[model samples]
Target chain A: MTPTSLNHGASAARPPAAGTFRFAAHTARIPALAGVGFKHTHLDAILADPDPVGFVEVHAENYMGDGGFPHRALERVRQDFPLSLHGVCMSIGGPQPLSEDHLARFKALVDRYEPALVSEHLAWSTHDEVFMNDLLPLPYTEETLNHVCSHIDRMQDVIGRQMLLENPSTYVVFENSTLNETDFIREIVRRTGCGLLLDVNNVFVSATNHGFSPMSYLMDYPMEHVGEIHLAGHAVQEDDEGEPLLIDSHDAPVADSVWDLYSIVIRQSGPIPTLVEWDSDLPDWPILRAEAAAADRILDEAAHSFLMGKSHAVGA
Target chain B: MTKATKTAFSGAVLAGAVAAAISGAQLVTATDAAAANVKCYGVAMAGQNDCAAGPGTTCQGTSTVDYQGNAWKYVEEGSCASMELPGERMGSLEPLERDMPS
Candidate 1:
């Protein structure tokens, strides 16, 4: 279905007033083009040759430390490309209240960098005070919905910007879940006024593990509120029953099927700013650039088709 | 001893502790600047290492064990030898036998 057909309930939530925060005057909004996760090892190569890269993303937790090379490299990257601050450990879906210290650090980074887009996952990572460092899944129910919405509200209120909540790649489904993933995410957008970061590879991975249709999930997603898209590679494993299990391991190239799924999403969503994440087993700059380039081709095709369709409708 | 004499002795010990803390912080900064590229073992907190811990791990935040000796983080070159840990252990250039999961 077209994004226009989706309910725009997210608009009902209050938006931040103008001049609530000041971003760098020179920095532009992230364009509807392909971007890549920023790696420190790639700083030199990126500075030397910045092509086919529309923006760059970095994990928010990684830069939470006080000033150092991480900030230095990010500052350089920001000067050249639009930045997307992706937080991996906010534990937004956890039952406990959000961490005040983590929120303060997140806000500090946002104020310092003024990223074009900011996002976090739908999963939880912290239990009590202990952090698991992995995106753990939560059951979909009214209780969880309330908790997730409260966390997202706090996060946006602190940062003073609309943050995108990304869909997670799950290995298991909760038998007690009352709502499906799409409906759960849609409710989050409706309540929090946050946009969505539709990770197509995650859709593929979860679909493969749980035996569902990724296309159906995409169709049911709140596409109109999608602010960004993430495409990453996952590792293949086996469940106890010997069925295929997928880990959202950002250690390899995007699989062929995932590329196809991404192409489909791009075709439907037009051209949201897409990022290719390769956090581990990093390739040389050129190799990662090629992955971004691959995404660019899909985005380009989608843009071209969209323009053509617009013209055709106008002619009619 | 008289109360005045006991209080004066306590003040001296407290002052010494503060002085040591200040110098220790300065030493870390100085050594960090002087030798910034050394891979100091058993220094990283759990899930906070700069990179992989070992097999089955990928990169940052993948360490399952806290202060895993096998997981090394880059620190000042010579400072690792002086950095102290609990149980009288010190940071090592090579992975230490302590802190590994049994």
Candidate 2:
């Protein structure tokens, strides 16, 4: 389950302290530490905070402007924090072809920024040229497998970088989906050579919605390809049958169950670049930092366990 | 943790504030009054255009909704609905399925 075969040379020495992340979870060309989703609200606070968090992420659609304050702010912030460009409306899993204009704008942004990590969801958000602001689920079939893989390939070709594809939280399943979600993603990674962004909240949400095990989904997932990890909070409501339906709302702090699952993945994957994503209803700056600092504490513990050759019982 | 990091961070912070000032002056000319109270977090991403009158589907703030290119100019907190520009019949943001899908 170790993302790579790097020997850590175990020592009896314990790690420094919680919230002090010293090493990269997994080594990449752009090494990273604990990161958070970039909200314009936190610009001044982030600029002023001396202890740098690993990186900050931005929604691609937010910065598609040719010339604007967003770009100015982003370019300035990029000086201090490594950036991860996240695409909210790429619609990569849709039946329609990838939007050339969207791709061009994204490419321009990527080219200008040269971000360390760029990611899009496995869910589709656009169809027939109308942009829906939601991440819709995809049916996992051989046809979908081929279609998504080709899209990933084209994206890598145009963007000139390996983009991380994130797992989505689903409410409904298609009868035609022949492959399980994990297997579907594994095939995409195997074929496209793109990386994975394992969103633990999504796993927990979809598993609870579909009546499955989050751990089992992780077991089946191709963990080695995971370049980044996402941790967020979700809202839970009941379905028509009075069943629990989890919504991927990035409006709150990291949930307890999600933090536990993230702990399990960290032990298995040995410290990936994890991000705290809060898109809407954003809290004050210190609250979000507290969440990122909390993720840092967990990552610190996982790295300590790995370094000390202990069982994955750091937080368990 | 290192001196190098602290120095870089402070430097970035200064640069971000300075850059924000420059852009605010050059692009968002109308909102200087609003800028007095708003910080970075107060500004959401260019509020997505609800109708075709919303320009800049390709660009972020070019929406014909508010200011020509500055429809995304930071609106006073809780004042997005009141800030009206020309030819604007604003559509509401679509609500997510809290309990059930329609």
Candidate 3:
């Protein structure tokens, strides 16, 4: 499934031992139910009385430094929760060759904290030498497919485990794209043996902004490749043509439509680890716990239904 | 493992252990106090200083320096309030209301 006949040169070398490296089974001690992204504001609460969520996720880029409070806090939570390193700045889908420095930093973090799952965005963040510090969109072209796959392969090889790629919340589309975002992502995963971090809110936002049906996108998405799910809130703006464009803003609660879509996704994919990402304008810890509880109820219902189906089969 | 290798790996494990202990300490602790002396600034493109409060926004007055090592100008509500005041260092910064770009 190599894209464009290009193969990442394989070496027999093992990755440098950075931190406490552990496999998924050891890393994710808890089952992949509902989790929340960790924030600095909630660290004390999380430390005092850990949330009842199944696990927690954090941005790997935030912990790339030597020694700090972020690392200390994460280490505390790691004892009781399965951690997934959801990185925001890897820029795997960028046009330029991957930066070895950034890759080294990622490796160091992975080695230090053996996350249950490691993930990055399916978009670029830098062009030439300018770091835009945003997950810019990528065209679904063959060249990009190859570029992203190579980056993922390099990451997997360096980290000694499979990585997850999250779909981008795009504001603009490239005219030269030959494939839709979903198909391109599927191809990347199929080629690199990576997983997908499906941000359902991003799908709804991008579909609304681009005049597409989010329902259809969900229908066609590869369910098995999804290792985790993200639910967040968005803000919508109308263009001069009076068309609404939704921005993936994590300052609010999950939209009703998104929650409905999430329930449907849970029915389809079973209960995977879901996260409520509130990066900006974070509210009190109680508000976030309530959000996690909502996701927990969905997962609980799904699990109950699953068991009921199994019992029915046994009786039959 | 080589001596150096063992040493580095030991250090990392020790760090991981310390991080773990701190995680335990943080559970019963209060939020750290904010830094007192640190200042925040935003350097935007020159001459487009309509940086005032918009709908659902607030603006503050501050001073900014342009490229080419020029003097600082007092910016009020995203507009230049005072003339370019020259000094060896950038003048005292007045807090400007920055509209959160949604």
Candidate 4:
């Protein structure tokens, strides 16, 4: 949906615990299992059946508006399922300073919903006060790192919650870039004390586009810093020169290779809150649920192994 | 090549590219048409099948084909495009590669 669709629905709610900003202390935690992106198309099915999944995540910008079906339905879903606020428009990595207006809107939503987790991307989508509504890549330089940290700190202050930063899926890289994507992400988390939302599809897409192994990038990433995981679909387009360009289009099923990488990530990170992001070609609720179930299986396996490790340690 | 030859060659190249893309798209469309009969749902698009402006709707029908060169095709009910949503195509990658918005 256009960023404009975010307009005209639901005023932000003050979190139940007023005056205190430490939302994580009381907020229902995102269960370390499979959750699906909440789509308007599936609202009816969700309201009717409320099928069993770990939790549900919604694009924070989508519900920024005031009093519409989105708010009504999302409120109902919130009653039964834990929710995470995922933002697509914060422009945290843009050259210009972060938008206070958007930040205020986000803060209001967080206060109202008290989502289990909150996240924005490490990419920018705005420049010169114009909102492009696309997640543009950032140059991984020392200067950019400082700029992004200031913005993230400001965001955490305004929202009064620990934020999670997701890596952007890139098609091209800057020539003068000094740091790799993993290093950049680690530095951001280190500096801001924010958590990470490691999108496996993004790692695979960026690694493939930039001529690297997805495994190496995952190994290099600070796995302990990750608070959540994202698995989505991508598309490959051939340009005018007949070369394949990978695009992070969340419109299909998670690719097999990405799924494998996700399993590996789970083996390392234990079980983080995982989301199946199908933003465009959203399938029926059952299809999306099936995708979530696949993720659930991975999470269940990982949790079992984790428990086994703990028990063995106790015995020793 | 001279400017005239360059222009002519570019024209031929554009024609070839368009033809190839259309043929490839048509093949995909044909596959969807074949799959349509077995699909259990129907997806409807507004203009282009971009999630931003055209997140589409769930409706019952055989896949609708926009023969007027609009980029949306019904892959399945409750499903629109398999690849990138149309609006996403105009994002950063286009400007970075060609200095023009797609």
Candidate 5:
């Protein structure tokens, strides 16, 4: 069956509060095309020419403050392209209860921008009311799974929408983890009724760091529920054991291997909304735009092959 | 200190506070124009600076250290001198040696 048709928890697991909040009547959905992470520095260039990409994404925390240049620029960008609000510090996987204040601000953004897609990392970053300022890994035990699901449920209820959760790149693994990463994620989706955001670069980084196969991880991933994809660059370093360690640094262009993996996923999944993220040490707008354009080319090819396959099957 | 005298004195204090607030607003307006392109220190909240987060940390949101006086954000050029922060710290034109959250 096609990945789109293999619904894991698409409609059945929505929280009752999902219907409480009303989105704008004209809220647009992100198309099955390539997008780029929206950088404030590229606002002028994007406004000057906004055609190269299908959508733009922003870190939700960056725009959480009261009215300022960030919000103003986002408003301008939202007028032109579909937006994705990617939250970095929700700490959904943390053992603590979700922060009501952070959730309220997140809900406010969802209400204000009405983004086409909303996502957060699977990793936790806060403990004891102190945010660690990084996406820290969590053990994949039954207890942790339950905690993550409850957090996801609360987040969905507060925002009144299903959120996509992105996989993380880890530097270390816990000996107490009862379940593997993919199985853990599958359980979270089964319980929380949320979607998955397949970050191919993250998959590559984690696979390399943990000595797992990226292809094998993708094969086991719950791709049917994937609503979005992320591609970013990583910094390479040596671990304490003198092994290669990859950091999800997002400071450079999409590496060639990541592009290859992204192509494979798109060819199979048939064109999810993919984002090219270059968060630090960013390049010129045209250079970033070129990266998105490259993803678009692959997506276009996948679309053609899918259409042709359907026509041939009908003929048969 | 009779009741009538005290009432008059309190009204004068209120008037002075109001006058000071009005002048402060005017100053802010005038300084706003000249504040462009100035690196103001000891103002950014935790994880909100444009970039840089001391040692052992990389890019944005990596700074768990809140309000590092060394981390400066671009604010209005002339306004940094007037901005007051918690702990009696003032925004500085250059990186500060004080108010580094421990």
Candidate 6:
């Protein structure tokens, strides 16, 4: 059903202590369990259901407003769940300087909530202060890499915590791209000491969009630096050349092929806190939670494999 | 009715808003006041908004352009139609502009 067709959590009450409320004293970490992206549509369902989601994530821009319903909802949700603030507008990859105002607002939010994990895309979302609002790709040049690492360093310093950089699902390859996407990310991790949020669906989508192997991309990914994982649905449509193009549209269920790739990665990475993101055509809360539960099963299997390996090592 | 199917009958748009009764009338009033205060920020060309523009803006970062008469940005109480906004996306009591003001 459509979001407008569902119950509006509009009637929910603000906590009496909301106005004077301060962020809890400690920072919350990313729980190594399944999570779903926080959507206004699903907030009440989340509070109503005790489904085993480890944490919740939100677009940093969504809650950047001064004060209102969005802020109240997020604060209440924060009281119940650990949060991961995934930013889309820091424009870390752009040649333009980072926005100090945006950083200060972000820092204020992070300070207030003390989120366990803060993340942003390796792509740029703004140009000359006009936000395209889409996560546009970056060229993988050495100069670009150094520039991005510095941006990450600055963001980490301002936020008072290390942030995770996500690999973007690209449609067009830059002619100036000099580094492989994986190594490009590896260098950023090395130079900035930031972590990676591996989006496997992006791996598959970019692989299909370009002529590369998703598996190989995953193999070369710096799994050592991964702190979180994102699995989302994408729209597969043909480009002008009749080649398949997969848009990172988080409006559908996890496809079988992407799930297969996730199965492989969870086994190797031994269960990073995976998230299911359904942003556009959001399904009911149960459907989203079931997807999280499915990820939990994969994590469980990964845990089982790791234990078996440990048993074998002990036996040897 | 099952929560998923029950949504068809109740027309609940979001869960957080769905659970408002428990927070008591203070919250319901607060939410209503917040809803009443949503100002249509006209400068939000394309999808430069958090949410509540119109179709194609079901989520953040989805608006392409040309906001309709139904879009809005949340604002503090009694301040709509007065606050200065950027570009042509001027402030209004309603979220939508009915036409591209810029």
Query: Which candidate tops lDDT?
Result: 5
> Which regions of candidate 2 are displaced past 4 Å?
A1-28, A310-316, B1-102
Give me the runs in candidate 5 sitting further than 4 Å from their true place: A1-27, A311-316, B1-102
Best by TM-score: 5
- TM agreement with the true structure for every prediction: 0.72, 0.70, 0.70, 0.69, 0.74, 0.71
TM-score per model for chain B alone? 0.25, 0.21, 0.20, 0.22, 0.25, 0.14
Chain A only: TM-score of every candidate?
A: 0.90, 0.89, 0.88, 0.88, 0.91, 0.88
What is candidate 4's local distance difference test score?
0.73
Error of 1 at A82 (Å): 0.5
Off by over 4 Å in 1: A1-27, A50-52, A311-316, B1-102
Error of 4 at A92 (Å): 0.6
Q: Give a tens-digit lDDT track for model 4, residues A1-316.
A: 1111111111121122222223343246566878888876786676676457888888887787777566876798889788888888888897678889889999998888878888899988778877766788888999999989999989998988788888888877899899988778767766676777889998988887777999888767766556788998888775456776567888889999999999987765567789998877568899889999999999899779777774442222
Write one digit per residue (lDDT tens) for candidate 1, span B12-89: 798998887676557566545334333343344443333442222111222122554766687767766565665565
What are the root-mean-square deviations of the candidates from the true structure over C-alphas? Answer: 10.1, 16.5, 15.0, 19.7, 9.6, 17.9
Error of 4 at A73 (Å): 1.5
DockQ-wise, the better of 4 and 5 is 5
Question: Could you tell which candidate, 5 or 6, scores higher by DockQ?
Answer: 5
List model 2 lDDT by residue over A1-316, tens digit each: 1223321212111122311222223222444368888776688889998777889988888889777567878898899878888887878998888999999999999888878888898978788978867788888999988889889988888887678899988889999999998878877766776777889998998999999999888877766667788988878788899988787777778899999999877776667788998876769888988898888888888778788875543333
Q: Model 3: share of native contacts present? A: 0.00
State each model's CA lDDT, in order.
0.77, 0.74, 0.70, 0.73, 0.78, 0.74
DockQ of each: 0.06, 0.03, 0.03, 0.02, 0.08, 0.05
Which ranges of candidate 6 are over 4 A from the true structure?
A: A1-27, A311-316, B1-102
Give per-residue CA lDDT, model 4, range B3-101, as digits (tens): 474555588798998887676557555546534432444444423322353222211111223447767776666533334444674443332322332
Candidate closest to the true structure, highest DockQ: 5
Candidates in order, interface RMSD in Å: 6.9, 10.5, 14.2, 11.6, 6.7, 6.5
